[model samples]
Target chain A: MAQKPLQFRLNGAEKAVFVEDGANLLDVLRRSVGDLTAKRGCAQGGCGACTVLIDGVPGLSCLTLAETVEGRSVATAGGLPGDGSHPLQEAFMAHFAAQCGFCTPGMLMAATALLESTPHPDRDQVVHALSGNICRCTGYEPIIAAVLEVAGEGGGGRS
Target chain B: MTIHRGRGFASINYPIGMNLGGDPSQALVHSSPDGKFAIALSSIDLGQGMKSVTRQIAAETLGVPVEDVYVDTADSDTGPHCMGSFASRGTHRVGNAVIVAAKEARAIMLEAAAEELEVNADDLETDGRGNIHLRGAPDRSITTGDACQAAQFRHGKTVAGRGIFLIPLSEVEPETGEMTPVSCYAHAALVADVMVDDETGEVTVEQVNSAYEVGRAINPRLVEQQLVGGAWMGLSHALYETTEPRYPDRSHGPVDFSQYTMPGPGDIARHDIAILERPAPDGPFGGKGPGEMCANPIMPAIANAVFNAVGVRVTALPITPEKVLRGLKANGGARPGPRR
Candidate 1:
């Protein structure tokens, strides 16, 4: 195992770390960077709990090799907002979008990308955007509603 | 060459907490120097909102604001004993224990306040904002912080309370097969609408409408989340979850998420939930835990729907395509007359 020097913009701040060969981005961020928000649900990428916004696009941190993210910008759930002031975070809290919160970081990152790009995505669009993420507790309705509410549609005002 | 649609319904009842040789949960409530409260318990939240709900119970019992109570669900070594947060017992079991502990701590606060005001303890009441006032005199009141200081310095007493909730074991008549294993039960009914592809034998759940009598909802939103999430888990179990490919043979099976299949966001159907509050007499704030019961009815509802659609009773756990095709071939592809 070889340690490689890696530099990236993490949560709006420049960070540098040394990673082992073949280590994924999640490992470097959690073990080296000390940000435990991006969870390691399934290292094989089946569960999207390790999703991160890489250059404003939702990318699976567990699937991404450390070397590939060199000099890239990464954003996690902790990086969303310090005070839970983001519209999405507020919507999630209001709508009860998170249950166990294990998958919240990835879900937030994925929803963040969708909102940044489309802003007002429909139900199907929201569903497709979050398809990669897996939330075992929320059942996807509240999460979708939170994203839709932040998008300004209120998700048909469903309870 | 034709697709069929069908509907089915199921109703089920599940016990809230089990009495396995005396199921018990404990809580410790103590007041802080700032008049705030801390409750230490061994029950893990597990994302079921235990911390929030238990904190509310403590605050309500102590006549304090919710923000003044801090719930610490530390490990068993440091906190009081809890039977763990399963079997939907976190709310019913832990909640009752918390109320008891909070009540004890509240008594001490009231006594201390009575001494300071030169009045009887019974004449003092809390405003739930950390203020203790006489029954008739609202202005003549002392903050809980003052009472706590008096209790520690003058009275030399620790303002702490301990509580435990337990159910006595029921003696069973083995000859008659009758016994009360649990004290209360939660009920639910669900209707599932589904579509079945005749050629491909693929099934799709279109909608799920359910009504749950959840004793009471401590937090309505958290209950809704549990119902929705549990329904999806039921869907996964009914359609796509299996660890063993062959019976008693683990030669070939899914070892990881990629190999294993569960419902993703795309598979979610329209869900309509009706929450009914039927209070239990012994429940803390009349709440029967809905943690495990949410997944009970969906499996049978989906199974019955597949049968109604194709006139084939596939009794398997997951009504997979291969099994449906085999059943169809065995029945000579005798499709019911277009479900007219």
Candidate 2:
């Protein structure tokens, strides 16, 4: 595969990178862009660890070709916190929402896409949106709570 | 090692004699003096809350918060050599060790408090933040950090908490192929309702109604999170989880990440999680393990739900569309079920 020069909007900053024709966005983001926030749990799209945003929509970067991301606005977990701060990220830490912190970035980004589109998702909707992301810990309660916090639910008020 | 061989004690039925929930498990908790803690856990947080629990135990022991304490939940190297993180040992053994270490530190602080306030050692209390004072006189108090500093300056760091947790060893001998219940185990029951695609075998878990006896809830939110994650993991194992072999399964399973099925954010339905706070005698806070509990029952529960919904029983996991179709065909090749 031949290397190609690709340009895209990352987080909110426009960036350019060169990668082989068949390289995945995951590799490009991790190696080329130096964004380690997007993890590599399963190279396949099955894990949701590599979930990202392609034009504000949730997507799995591991299975997506780098070529597909050209001229598109890309978002990683790192990108979600435009001001280096997001309520979802705060709720995650306040609620002990992260364990290894490896899955934290990925999980936050995935949920960001969901909450951004639907601000007040019901419990069922919350589960459906998070179905693709696997959190071996926290089951789904606190994560749901964190998302619910954004919608003015009982998240930070922990006993 | 009592393997009762009567009617119910036979291979499948032999829970007959000895004990139902005797010991906690193989690796429990062992504590030392200061606040050094270790846990030999049958349970793991796997990014859940074990680490926090460990820290909580250490800090709470002497009336401190999490930031003032540090605990190592899992150890691949020389742990305080703790066990693997699988069950819910964070509150069990690890918490107990913190109790022990904190108690030790508390004794010293109590004696000091008694001398300073002219009260009984027991009459004194270490506030939730490690500051020692008389029961009612919050005015007469001393910080644990100060105490430690004083102690370190004089006697050199006393009452360090250390623990070794061994779960009930259910070691199945490779030679005999037998399961030996090393310690008492943790159990959970879940009731799940799901919607399935009759044509695609695609199933959506709508709700999970479950109750677990994990001894205690050191951090209720964290436990709930574990349950949610565990439930999803269970769903994956039952329906979609796959390890694309070093190569591929002889069963013609797909090798592509997109093709290899696993639970993702899109596949889950809403959940109703209920945590049962039944304190296990063997558990730390009476907390039994819930790490793998939710996962094991998910697939089984889904299969049962499918049976209740229609009239098809698919023994195999995941109950994919193809399996449902085949099962439907096998059952008189008809759309099997009593569709209301």
Candidate 3:
């Protein structure tokens, strides 16, 4: 296989790596970039476990071509504020939104996009936004509640 | 083309831990020089909060703060032996082993503290806040860290303990052919409300109300997580999930999540759960395993709900729209049964 050069701003840091042609962004980020936070689950763009921020929009990294992200900004779950202070992370912990946690990074990214755009989405909106992500363990109740809690909507005001 | 609503109910009792020769799990507990305890086990968590629950059991048994305990479920080579995590036995079996190991380590810890304080081991008690004191003498106390340090350096003793839990297998009676398969059981009941469209024969679960009598809720939040998630999985199994839609043919098998069907976040219904605790006699902290039983009742409840909604007794794993329509057509029309 032929290799290609790709450069992207990863989590606000410039990253340059050589990738095989047609390699998806998920493989490049995990295998080359050493960012294992983005999980590889059902790498067919259906599970949404590899969802990442591509230029401030939530996109499936598993389906994205690495060359397309060249010079573009890519953000993963690791980019979330550390120290356990991010509102979504705090809300997730308080609400027990993550189990097994394979889907947490993508769920957080999707919820992050929703909050950034709507800021106070209703229950139906939250459900619609998170429909693509599949969590085998959480039943989607706590995940939705965590996102809604951050939006000051639900979660029993626990957040 | 009208949509009809109906309700159905189901109840079930599930056994905790399998009775295969002796389902055994072992645990090892040892204290570091700083008095922090580490539990080594081969049981896997698999996102079921196994590590967290065992840590709590060890801390409680040792009379120490939960933060002072760490559960290391490393590989089988480094950790002790386990019969694997299945049959919902992680809590009941592994928890008991952890309690036993922690108790032994606690006894050793108290012995070291007694030696340092020039008192009997029976007269010393842990404060659960990193301190051990002589009975009736609050001023005469030593920090757990100091005691552990002394045990390692001055006393030439290792504050460690090993534990294993097993239930002897029951032999079948040749005359009656009866044998005890499990030690304890967890019970659950569920009521499911669903809406069925007469035209397309689509069924949508609207709400679910359930009650679970787990032996005891070791961690109430973790138990709730299991209930909610397990019920969702049940709902999926009843209506959506199928590895091979064309079963015997196996031609159009699903290769990825897109072709595979499961309930999405939008498909989740409203769930109301009530947890009942009737502690088991031989359970750890009077707690039984609630991992696999939470999803058992939803399948039957949904099937009965479909029957009530359209009078079609679709006995298949997934009551898909085609099956419902075929049943409705075969029955000559929509014959709504009595609503539960």
User: DockQ winner among the candidates?
Assistant: 3
CAPRI band for model 3: medium
Angstrom error at residue B77, model 1 = 0.8
User: Which stretches in model 2 have alpha-carbon errors above 4 Å?
Assistant: A1-25, A44-48, A51-75, A79-85, A93-103, A110-159, B1-45, B73-75, B87-90, B105-123, B135-139, B157-159, B165-185, B194-204, B242-251, B333-340
- lDDT per residue for candidate 3 within A68-151, as digits (tens), equals 999999989999877778889998999999889999999998888888778888989999989889999989999998888888
What's the TM-score of every candidate structure? Answer: 0.94, 0.72, 0.97
> Once superposed on the true structure, which residue ranges of model 1 sit more than 4 Å away at CA?
A153-159, B246-249, B334-340
TM-score winner between candidates 1 and 2: 1
- Candidate 3, overall lDDT? 0.90
Clashes in predicted model 3: 0
lDDT digits (tens) for residues B83-113 of candidate 1: 9999999999999999899889999988988
Error of 1 at B318 (Å): 2.0
lDDT of 2: 0.62
Top TM-score hit: 3
**Each model's DockQ?**
0.74, 0.46, 0.79
Q: What tens-digit string does per-residue lDDT give for candidate 2 at B131-238?
A: 777788899876655555545455554534333444454556899988755334556676767666655655666776676656577778677767777677777766
Q: How does chain A of every candidate compare to the true chain A by TM-score?
A: 0.93, 0.90, 0.93
Question: Model 2 chain B, poorest ten-residue lDDT window?
Answer: B3-12
- Return the lDDT, model 2, position A107: 76
**Candidate 1, residue B133: CA error in Å?**
2.5
